[model samples]
Target: MRRITTVLLDVGGVLLLPSSEVMRAAIGHSGIDTTDEQLRRAHYAATAATDANGGPDRVEVYRRTFAKTCGVPAEFEDAVHDLLTDQFTGYTWQRVAPCAKEGLELLLAKGFRVGVVSNSVGTIEEMLATAEVCQVGGGPCAAVEVIIDSAVVGVRKPDPRIFHIALAEMGADAAETAYVGDTARADVDGARSAGLWPIHLDPYGDCPDPAGDHDHLDRFDRLCDLLTSRSGE
Candidate 1:
């Protein structure tokens, strides 16, 4: 264990884990005529790609991304648009659960600098509002120093570049900062690449193995325990 200067967080499974069932319902309702594979491709681009603030143009990003998979006629553009919008609109932030809020409050109050490293699109503010996170406009989330949305910052995770941006914003030494995220390649690999330790969460049992030393958690409910203990140790 090492002294912690900052704690970077992931949004998707770490903050407000989306309901796959709910998202599927929205995509199905969009009336996009496409095969199963194509539909899945389109859905991911719309939701995942937009998570970061600055990246590819929205329309072309998804349109070209899903084109190879869907291979739908020119009409796929309209369908992709409808399906993505519907999916984002269906995002649910279960406030009562509050895994991130609980951990964030503990980190901030303990004097550990905190920041958000989430990939989002459309708007991070909207997601935070739904999640009830108080970091809106950089005031602080129960004491978390700052939140950097990939979309807001013009970058996204898995790029390593975005993590560098987050570290710079936090003014934290890479060795002293730990990034906790759910996705293996995107979060864990990205953190490792950025020279930050990684703590991976696998609540739903989907997390994968990593190549080097790392810690994995089954549930985020005890995240506060992990961070606080890490800093003290």
Candidate 2:
């Protein structure tokens, strides 16, 4: 394991996720009497269904599953979709990971270049800005130097080429880069395909073998420790 020079991260689930409470509240606001437990179950169900049967109609699949699991009415299906999809647009609706900003600062302080590689709706930067992650000490933080958005670039994750785009932007080699992501297929597999090391963030320990086989960190701050361990090796 060579010393890593750059760290690439996924946005949703890694840095920011729609908080469970927020999701429940939003659904409740839409006149759906859903529980936090139901939402969590549906969240995993949506992911698993998407992984099992992938298609362009993933949102529909999630909607159907979520609505069924939460006992949401057909009328509230549209509301559920809208809230989940647009949660990032409003700061109050998102849950910024406790370790994200700190981890970015740690990487920058350690002289490692950091960037965000997300499959978002072309609002990755705006979301980060809204969360005030782009600022540190009232100044712009150079910690995150690049943000490669799939929507803007017309390429999404699980495509190794997207990682190449970020590598090119950073002027770094894949051999010395590490991509941190929560999803096994999109982030871990994709990063591996691009010739970079893959680290999985398995907070819940739900991912099974192979996909969850790589180095695992329960939190982003632990990434600094992993990097240090690599440096010593």
Summarize candidate 2's per-residue lDDT along 17-72 as a digit string, tens digits.
65667677657756776655566555555554554455788667755665556777
User: Which candidate has the top score in lDDT?
Assistant: 2
Per-residue lDDT over 170-195 for candidate 1, one digit per residue giving the tens place of the 0 to 100 score: 67888888898866667887898998
lDDT of 2 at 137: 27
- Model 2 misplaced stretches (Cα beyond 4 Å): 19-22, 29-49, 52-93, 135-138
Tell me how many clashing residue pairs each candidate has: 11, 0
Q: Which runs in model 1 stand beyond 4 Å of their true positions? A: 19-86, 89-98, 136-141, 210-213, 228-232
Q: Report every candidate's CA lDDT.
A: 0.62, 0.74
Error of 2 at 200 (Å): 1.4
